[model samples]
Target: MECPYWLTSSQVGVYGRAAPEDFTADYEHWKRVVAQSYLNGIGISWSSVRNVMDMRAVYGGFAAALRDLNVWVMNVVSIDSPDTLPIIYERGLFGIYHNWCESFNTYPRSYDLLHADHIFSKTKKKCNLVAVIAEADRILRPEGKLIVRDDVETLGQVENMLRSMHWEIRMTYSKEKEGLLCAQKTMWRPKEMEIIKSAIA
Candidate 1:
């Protein structure tokens, strides 16, 4: 079956002062973009819309802004534990989450079509993206598409990597979405112990 494009959000860390203006503008814009994307039959699905909704509900006014959208946006929270999966599945959704709190050697499996938002710009945090993309592909259903909105700037490398993994690059939008970079997750494989060890050695 063809994999669907899924939305993935990143974990919010204690970065610089919060930018409410940017956040609000982006949230409304994204709501429209997402709504339009889904309405156009682009195979788009939200990963953890609940989280975004909760965070932006009061501050970003998402409920009203996205009320007219027809996409199946589910209630979601950060997936810091495996237990979060059943909750999402109960909602009739196959969502994606990231686990970057580990070493490169301990990279986790990609949840097919994992949805992620706001990746780190620094190198240390940037390394986590591989795991994010890898896991998304790993757990994704056949021909699944992974969707992400991150702050990283290496689009070429990211696109190449996805293609190498057999994912078809459907479409990509730059910081136009308020520093929210979006990409599709296609065919991908979770790196095996043999492959990792071989590369390490």
Candidate 2:
């Protein structure tokens, strides 16, 4: 088979867009490394996690990177970002356009896992972050995992919100200004809600 010229380190494909440091010859390998490390840390069983979403997909590299995994990735390009949905389809992957400030058009607990790369920083300037966090809680399954990579400040704020929802903060790491947070959602109910249910019963 003939190799695509754009797959080389020097080219940005037909879109001619993507992070400059991204998509080197080792791009896919780097993603595989990241996926392996995080999955090992979280102890996710591939048998259970069938569907995944890349919330801030740029050039669909994250999806391309996970080709070896026994999972499917839905690349979501933020409406605020470049319109690269065409490129995603061109690569024979899946994708959609979305605005994080608004709720995604799907039922609750749709995704088994979510990879949010720098989504908070971009969405924060325009909308109430509480709404965004609530939406995340809505879309992820009860036992689903959320992997967020964002600036340290945003991660701090995000941790507080997720904690408030009773989601377990499984792991958190930061280097200088950037940060990573892994959390697992639970079906925990508030004490007040339980009391109300008891009274009704």
**After superposition on all CA atoms, how large is the RMSD of candidate 2?**
6.2
Q: Which ten residues in a row have the lowest lDDT in candidate 1?
A: 51-60
Q: Tens-digit lDDT track for model 2 on 1-201?
A: 113334455645433533333434335544765676765765666678878998988777777777778888889998878676876777788999998877787743399998898898789898877778877887888999998999999999999999999999988999989988999999985676322231122
TM values, all candidates: 0.46, 0.80
lDDT of 2 at 201: 25
| Deviation from native of the Cα of residue 176 in model 2, angstroms | 1.2
Best by TM-score: 2
Candidate 2 positional error at 186, Å: 0.3
Q: lDDT for every model?
A: 0.41, 0.77
Superposed by TM-score, candidate 2 places the C-alpha of residue 2 at a distance from the truth, in angstroms, of: 9.7
Q: Total clashes, candidate 2?
A: 0
